[model samples]
Target chain A: MGISVLRVENLIKRYESGFALDIPHLEFQSGRIYGLVGPNGAGKTTLLNLLNLLEEPTEGEMFFEERRFTDLDPLDIRRKMTMVMENPFLFHTTVFKNITAGLKCRSVDKKMWPAMSKEALRTVGLKGFENRYAPALSRGETQRVAIARALVLKPEVLFLDEPFTNIRQRDIDLFEKLTKTINQEYQTTIIFTTHDLPQAHRLSDEVISLVDGRIIEGSIENLFEGTVEEIDGTQSVKISPKISVSVITEKRGKVNISIAPREIILSHGAIISSARNSFKGIIRKIQMEGQTVIVNISVDEEVEFTALITETSFKNMGLPIDSEIYLTFKSTSVTIF
Target chain B: MDYILEGLGNALKMIVSLDSEMAEIVFVSVKISTISIILATLAGVPLGFYVAIRDFWGKRAAITILNTLMALPTVVIGLLIYSFISRRGPLGVLGLLYTPWAMIIGQTILAFPIVAALSLSATQGIDKRVEKTALTLGANNLQTALFILMEGKFALFSAIIAGFGRVFAEVGVSMMLGGNIRGFTRNITTAIAFETGKGEFALGIALGMILLTVAFSINILFHYFQKKRM
Candidate 1:
């Protein structure tokens, strides 16, 4: 926890098709579970592969434990780090043999195999399946065995790619509990890729959101409820699901506008308002729908917008449909894209 | 038709009575085929392993050639060995023609391709995970190869049995190369050919019974291996 376990700077991976993965920067603190959230084709697997040293990054330096990962031997890197893909591959053997396969290769003490195997099985809640054939294990059990195979190594960093996609429906709770126990007990740094928002939120200390192979939002709590756009030669950001202001007049590089909707306080109609610009628009349609009254307005024959107001505000204005209204909003709320 | 019945009866009687001469021919056939198949397996199994796992230039061509050889006509191989062992042939000074050694050479060649090609298919047909998982589990090259080969024991066994079966039942190579001289190179297949052609149906049928029994035993062994594997 005290050291920066994984340090990735300016990572970019290029595919044969010329598509590139452009992750500006990423850092994973040691002994913490970091969730990588992205849609399909967002380079999540590519990023994981690079981290596992299964593939080389096109451009970027990756560091693990203050040592450059590219400098490590491939076998040494594999021995230290383990990855469990969505579909884990199991050998065609009895469960006992499959579990002991890795250890057998390294030639672990023969007496230790049983104790080690029993502990691993119990950790994954697969207690009574020691002698069963690996292929006959249930899908969840198979994954658990795969986990056991890696867990036998006791890897420093475990990278899981969509760890719970094919988990049995009934084992979801068991898996969550198992992960929490492993994280708490082993203090293992778990880096998992998942698309389930709630699962990520539940398991992750930090979530990185990727879109179109770029990090649009890298932090969990930094989401902005707005659609970004450029208008009039300047990048402007418009907050969505609300229409408070409309354009009034256009100048060379700037525009003047008035606020619509009585929701904005007009203190004397000339007093300074938090809203920098306001606009005037003719009310096009007004009706009561689903708990709120819908008010559609046309501003300057160019922009159309909608605003929600309280029923009390609607009655106090006593305004009829198709009437003109003034709207105002704060400049801070309108962030530049 | 009468001779066919007498031959069949004598064949059964010889097996039941365990005739010493008939047993001698059966023993020679088993020895030759077993030895030839073992040699073929030793030479061809590794070739199978290489063909299945390694990627290189001409690998496909090599495998194609081996596959083509699997169907090589037995008599053609007999003629080839005959030419090499005849007085005018290159190794004629050694005078190996009409000997059991000559038959062994011919039979080994005839079975080598079958063993190698089948073993290649068997090894190649193994689950891809078997190798990848072994590698990912920290196995070095030799360990991974050995691990995969161990998992494919049944297939390797089948390949060996197939080679043995092919060589044991084949007559063209043994007859042309061994000359079927009695009390020596005359094996079960060659003995059957000679006895039937000479109107000695009893011995011919006796040899046929022993050969069929050997084939049946190999089949049973294969079944046992398969069951044990499953």
Candidate 2:
């Protein structure tokens, strides 16, 4: 709905350890919140580093505001965007100095530093913390200072790499609110990476799912890597020791499969169904994402599956936590890659 | 035993009275070591930092060479410099031998490898995120490098102190290069060596006490910085 602020074409990054990130195309619009969802080693952080210009792609062209990245000075471009790492490393000095680090680098007048830093701190709900030493702050407070440091620069884009990892729930709620405020007030284009599916859907206007360095359609929930096998004239993937899902795949050997959360039907009891795959599971957790209710069910206490349903269906079904349930899906719904 | 006790007593007396000769010796030793360490730090810190952050062919080999130099014997450096600055040597036209300048040059060589090697380790020990954080915050390449140096300041301070300690206690380079010129180039270590050989036990013991105190203080400061870094 907005103008494109960043676009990547045919991007690729290769590491010495044989890990490679390949993106055919991607675009980020201004004034929009985008969430990158992936598991560990899924290249979420690598992509963020490339988009933030903290790294050079092994092969690709990046465009910012229709201007080619190679045509612009990296420092100048970086000043327009900033990133807060998951484990933010604060400078070994006063919080004030850390918050004003960017401004100092820009050669801003010394007189305006105090007021600017104070204002930025206030935005993160950390007023009156200027004199405190950076290394002495608590984990949550250190993250807040790091956010304030990035905010003080008034960057056009903000990248948060797993900002909520190892954070308390209360702090997570606060950070979510802070992210929204920064987007709404400053119209900053924000890109954040997380492995939490429900959180990603709740926070971003668009969610990009990544698996093993490649982007894929649909939510990343219920993704499993297993071996394909033909057992008794049926083709299924053995996801776990106690769980197997029927799939319409001719390929064999190790493979990855994903099931769309919405395609699964939940039932209170095992019933006759036309679906090819059905598993009895227990409700592990329930979450609300807008009008959709996300139910997490564990099968045989070994494999967990996430199913999405409308709030009305969820309320009518009256499913309780820890209750036994049956989840059924069509063989065609299980996507193998 | 009586002679040793007498020497100890007279040494304490000379120290308490601030004997002029003892003071001159201490001053010269401090001045020469301080200058050499300063010069070494100026040259070594940046060299070490540059090597630590950059990837190049033979980088490991370069670091190995610097580590090897840290253990170089003082007399070897003295002999090496002696060849260059001695009469009829390549640098003999400047007449630098047997002067305080020659001693400073030799001590600087003795301290260079220690400072550079330790500084390399110090810079390498810094968290990798520090550089990324600074660059993401809009710092230029030079600023980012300086920011990392600032972050590793404690370890670097310990490195420079270690260099000072090595040069301050060395007698071979000072004796060979400085020729132990009294009131000019003679220092605590050379004075202690010469006076003890001449059987002037009081002065020798007094200077030895001073040298130990200085070395002890340097170690305390070094440990303090090392603790601060952690």
Candidate 3:
């Protein structure tokens, strides 16, 4: 909606083990909390590392504030951003020092250090811990202090790399509240990665799905949840009167389904396939990613999903926006949660 | 049997008497060893941190060389420095041949690889995410390396103490480089060697006792750091 704060094009990171992070294109808007949801080895941390400037991409271009990321001084760029890793590591000093180390590095005013750090500690629910020895802190306390350490800087973008595991539900609620407050009051753009789908759905203003190295664009809008219906023991969920998606699960009263955009096949007419799921929808939007195309479709008035196809396939089909199309998916490809 | 008893009695008297000769030699030993370990700590900790954090070509080979140098024989180091500072040797013109500075230089070389190799091991055992945390928290490359050095501070101190222990008890470097100059350059180990060679076991046994105490104290420090790391 506004000028993008961070953007990547054709990002690729390759390991000697043959694993890679191959992002064709992605963008992050200013002043909005975004969540990266994916499974392990799905390249969430890789993306975070690249965005944080901790690692250079094997092949790609990154733009920050409309300038090439590599063209700017990386240290200056990194100082403006902050990241909290999954494992909390504090400087070998008092909690006060841990919270103020970045401020000291940035040459913040000395008179403001104590009060700012104390308020930061309070915000992360770590009040009265200013003098505590960092190494002696419990794991949860350490994580909270880490959050305080990052938040005290009041960075432009705060990147959290899967740091919320093992947190209690109450702490999770507090974290959610803290993120919302930071987003609303401070206008800090929060980008966090998580394996918890519901938390992502709850915490993020928008969510990006990364599966196998590629960004699943429009994944947040495409996640559909509905009451389960079993017709002759075929498990399905009815999102609307016109749409029911087949699922691979047996036990279901209510369930959530996620279909990768690439898994859904688009056709201009009824397509013959052994696949169990098919629905009629109109193309709502279309955008190109690299050489491929992403098509957003709405089967019901309220339910929208996306499909990935080639530009060649799109041109051969010659379907314009709002054109009716049949989409099909195999039940095995439908993930239930 | 009588000589052994007499030596023991004389050593006790010498230690209680605070003999100036013994004190001066002790002072020289500590001075050179202290300077050497300080230099080693300054140079080695950063090198170790770099060895721990950065990945470059031939890093494994570099680490292997350091690990090998950890067990390097003090006699070999003595001989190497001896050749360099000897007349007709490359560094002979400086004329530091039989002085305390020569011993200091030799001991510094001896202590450096120990501090570096141990610090490297210590850095490797630290939390791997600490570097990333430092970088993300606004530390530049040099500051991040210093932060990693800080994280392994205990080990680095222990490395310094261990280096002190090695050079303090060392005989070869001081003997070859200091020429065992009694009032000027003779340290605990070389003095003991000279006194023992002359059948004057009293001062030799006394210095041996001091050496044991220093080594035992260093061991205790090493163990304390080991426990802290765990």
Candidate 4:
């Protein structure tokens, strides 16, 4: 494990609209990609803004490299990190000007700006785009330029909010590779937010799941990466050699699918149901989260699935740890990304 | 109709011949208005930018006050400045009254509010993201403010041009403050007012034509920048 680069304790952000983010503790290590995954309005962007020092937390403290945010000059601390907004606003100028804006602010030598901007643009596969007028560029090109603008600063920590939301599938793959290259080559700590669970799992060394402004353990508990295939005239994803679950996707390729834990119906025995996928498994663990019970099940001793059921249902079924159980869910419950 | 045609013909002849007195009047008008507009721009742009970006008490009221001042009467500004520069007033020792300096001062006052108020609107119309983007990229508050001003450059340019237009064609300030001294403090508007009062319509008509041309050109430039901004 690397040294902790950023740490937050008892952070709280309150808005006049009655939305508040209260996080107890979190830490980010140096030179590793961390994915913050959550649905819309889950405070992902808000957290990114706080961590990047774009806004101060209402309570508690944040530290960068063991220095409290309040103790460090905001300009100095912000210079060490940069954030590329989800919908980046590029300056109305040439791409070169936009990319070197930070360098100018930092009072960097004017002679090195050209080389640095070119290299950053090349990193984003936008070679020779320095002279392009920002307002004339396409949306994808603008996003790349924004990334290059941040990359040229060589920040110690880079924050990206929904970096791939506006990108096409092919470019998304390219950008994902570019992101990995940046991390591996430069060793810059990267923290990004996305609601796409699979992308988070595929890219980050750690995935932090947030729901309704709080981090939860089982939000991504049922995520599975598999190859989508049509078998026996039905579309399904083959998770393991012995497990193929039906899905409702026309896509044929490697994909990631997630089933909401609450969507799975826990049964004592397999009964006739409209659900397309049913598996018999042994419950490996049972846990409680407020009024809901989380049941971790291992099927055929190969794949694991987590299901959420109310405490009342768990008691009615009289389920216990290490007990055989039946789990069933409809194909539509699977979200492919 | 014949009287008007005769005046137009003589006015064209005088303009084409570049009458020295007429040329001097035009020069004075351009010089004083240009200097005044420049001073107003220097003072107003930053003032407008600061007000647009910072939140303070009575900001809305401040903006309302600025908007009201945009329509400030030229004569009222002349009267207010006249009192200050008059021999009995505080600034009388400078001897600025009845001179080009006096006119410049009045015009600067007349144009300042227009420039500041329009610039406020220009900066306010800028996307809020510009500030955040610059700050996230390591810009200090001053640099971020500069970046936002750059982003709204076109509209700000139009603001300055609007200020120039307001001061360039105003007659009340120049007539009252400059005392319409021919071959010295006289400008286009004052020249037109003086020549017409003397029943010498040719020079007045020529200066009127020049004034219309300048106003038309300013409008063209303003519209060009406004379009580019959009």
Best by DockQ: 2
Please list the residue runs of candidate 4 whose C-alpha ends up more than 4 Å from where it truly belongs after superposition: A220-337
Error of 1 at B220 (Å): 5.4
TM-scores for all candidates: the values are 0.73, 0.96, 0.79, 0.81
Pairs that collide, model 2: none
Categorize the docking of model 2.
high
For each candidate, the DockQ is: 0.36, 0.90, 0.53, 0.71
Number of clashing pairs, model 3?
0
> Better model by DockQ, 2 or 4?
2
Which candidate, 3 or 4, has the higher lDDT? 4
Q: Using lDDT as the measure, name the better of candidate 1 and candidate 3.
A: 3
Q: Sort all candidates by DockQ, best to worst.
A: 2, 4, 3, 1
Candidate 3 chain A TM is: 0.67
Candidate 3 CAPRI-style tier? medium
**Which residue pairs in candidate 3 collide?**
none
Order the candidate numbers by lDDT, best to worst: 2, 4, 3, 1
Off by over 4 Å in 2: A228-235, A249-254, A288-292, A310-318
TM-score of 4: 0.81
Per lDDT, the best of the predicted structures is 2
True-structure lDDT of candidate 2: 0.94
lDDT of 2 by residue, A28-138 (tens): 999999999999999999999999888899998999988999999888889999999999999999999999999999999999999999999999999999999999999
Clashes of each: 11, 0, 0, 0
- Interface RMSD (Å) of candidate 2: 0.5
Writing each residue's lDDT as its tens digit, candidate 4 over B27-67 gives 99999999999999999998888899899999999899999
Against the native chain B, each candidate's TM-score is 0.93, 0.99, 0.95, 0.97
